[model samples]
Target: MHTTLLKDFSVSAAIAGFVTVLVGFTSSAVIVFQAAQAFDASPAEIGSWMGALGLGMGLTCIVLSLRYRVPVVTAWSTPGAAMLITTATGVPMEEAIGAFLISAVLITLCGFSGWFERAINRIPMSIAAGMLAGVLLRFGLDVFISMQTQFVMTFSMFCIYLIMRRFSPRYAVVTALILGILIAGSQGLLQIDTVRLQLAEPVLTTPRFSLSALIGVALPLFVVTMASQNVPGVAVIRASGYTVPISPLIGWTGATTLVLAPFGAFALNLAAITAAICMGREAHEDPARRYVAAIAAGVFYLIIGLFGGTVGSIFAAFPQELVLAIAGLALLGTIGNGLLTALIQEKEREPALITFLVTASGITLFSIGSAFWGLVAGGLAIAISQVKR
Candidate 1:
């Protein structure tokens, strides 16, 4: 019955899932890896994170999609990963875990009380879109700049993506990945020696909850994860043409974070750019059938969890230019749409544009990343406009 509207459940869903995780993992898993390095995490602890992240994101997507019967794809919060990389560095692993616990508690409260959902709903969609666009602009720059070093391999795959997107847009990423691999292989850019399959060991870090850690780590983490990660994450979902319970998602991610905190899972929330890939029409033409793709993504995430070491190694083997090209290429559509949406409404246009520019400017104040500041600038713009109007 559902097939009539959606068609090819397992196959399409599997492809969608593969693309989602492949793209998602390739993009920011490194940040998480780096965070682990900062805290001197053991390989097993890192693997545990992969496992927990896989389980948390996979279970959430499966349940949410099944319950809502919408393609409610959940992602391991990208903003949180960025926050950890920037803010959690040098802090003891235990304190990081403590911060995670605190953030999770706060997150659970938000979900249960529904305060977060209400606040998020208040943000104008255009501003949200603008912020997303601003965040992606840096990535777009990397893609082009990479061409100077890896002109042949990166540009070749990029051209393939462009051509494929013009035709079989759904398979654009798959095609790019395959072609990039082949090109990289031909150029000896693929480093197979680094691929090592080892069981990931889980390291238990004792939580040392402290006021300083809470102020320095937890608050910033919660703020960025909620404002930058969850906010844009849900925006990606709604913008991609689906609706789900945001509060419950926050609750679920918080629950997962609480469960995995000891194992080095710092934070988990919905993903924005990565989620966009899975939720977009390119994932599947029929929005109704897209859950299959999300389920597929969950499965891929499970693979990531299972062979966290090997998978991370293999992805790490790829040329940075190759990853940069593919990521930038994949996000082009979402970026274009975000810019357009931000500037659409006349009253919101100036503020939205200002928000976009400020975000794209890559200004970092007080060691805080661009995501939080973009929201601040954008929100301030919106507030000023409302006062005048």
Candidate 2:
């Protein structure tokens, strides 16, 4: 078993895993931090939040990927965290924890009951592909957008990425990342001085359920996580052509989040964006070997959990443009694939285009994200077309 595992692992897979963690943490971690602060959590409590979330994501990503032999990644719900920042204001920390627990319970129920998967399955693949494309469109655009401010670094990474894609496709993202880091370091853009090594200790908060929190915080968190995060997450997995069982994936993440919520794991769900980093061909030439990338990501998540503060500071030290450039470059393949799949079916093309446009527009309504709205709009378009037919 050990020898087989060793054989399956590759340098490209490991680098993909590292990039997954880097993009996941650097992108929305600060919003999570702000959400913690909204509940008036202390610094130690915030670290505990990071620790619990890291542990939950790590466990799910590793165990699920190994079990299914697919790149099954999990992440904290960024939309849920954003909702918390607004709704958790003035809510006691204890009550907020209780709300987190409630949200987890709801997610777990949805998973075990298989309702969420059933609903997701009804949505046609083209529509799902459109939603996935919309969600990823920003990252693809950001590769060039980063050039506006950091032309030397971003453009160099982009050129290296294209060159690598033409010659050594498997190593393109990793090569681009290395070049970006080297250039950023040379430009004195890396803030290496501020990172301090510190072990994160979990600080437990006992649950104190309140009606207001349950109604205000828990329900909204649950809704946003399901609609905005998990929906697109499942879409990514399917669009990538992986048939891993979605119910168990959702169930395990909910179970993990439930276990860690008291320690500040607000919400855990399937990962869409970072999962693409691991699922794409860039992770490995053979799709069967791509599970190694998810396993590698799990190891990195454990490191982040154990040394939450240190890892957070390390991610923070990198220049924003470098992160943006690398992420955009890494995801280029997945985004292009999504767009192609979305428009391939003539019957679904128009609706899929609507979904893509609405999603890329980044419009939010009733606190839900563009992903959910895009799905709704596409679904409606399909319904209308059927009626006309």
Best candidate, lDDT: 2
Instruction: Give the TM-score of each candidate.
Output: 0.87, 0.98
The residue-level lDDT of candidate 2 at 61 comes to: 90
Error of 2 at 356 (Å): 0.5
| RMSD for each of the candidates | 3.1, 0.9
Worst 10 residues of 1 by lDDT: 4-13
Q: Write one digit per residue (lDDT tens) for candidate 2, span 322-361.
A: 9988888888889999999999999999999999999999
Which residue runs of candidate 1 sit more than 4 Å off their true CA positions? 1-16, 73-96, 204-212
Candidate 2 clashing pairs?
Answer: none
Among all windows of 10 consecutive residues in model 2, the one with the lowest summed lDDT is 1-10
Q: Clash number for every model?
A: 5, 0
Model 1 Cα lDDT, one tens digit per residue, 242-302: 7777888888888878887877767778777667666655566677777777767776776
- What overall lDDT, based on C-alpha atoms, would model 2 receive against the true structure? 0.93
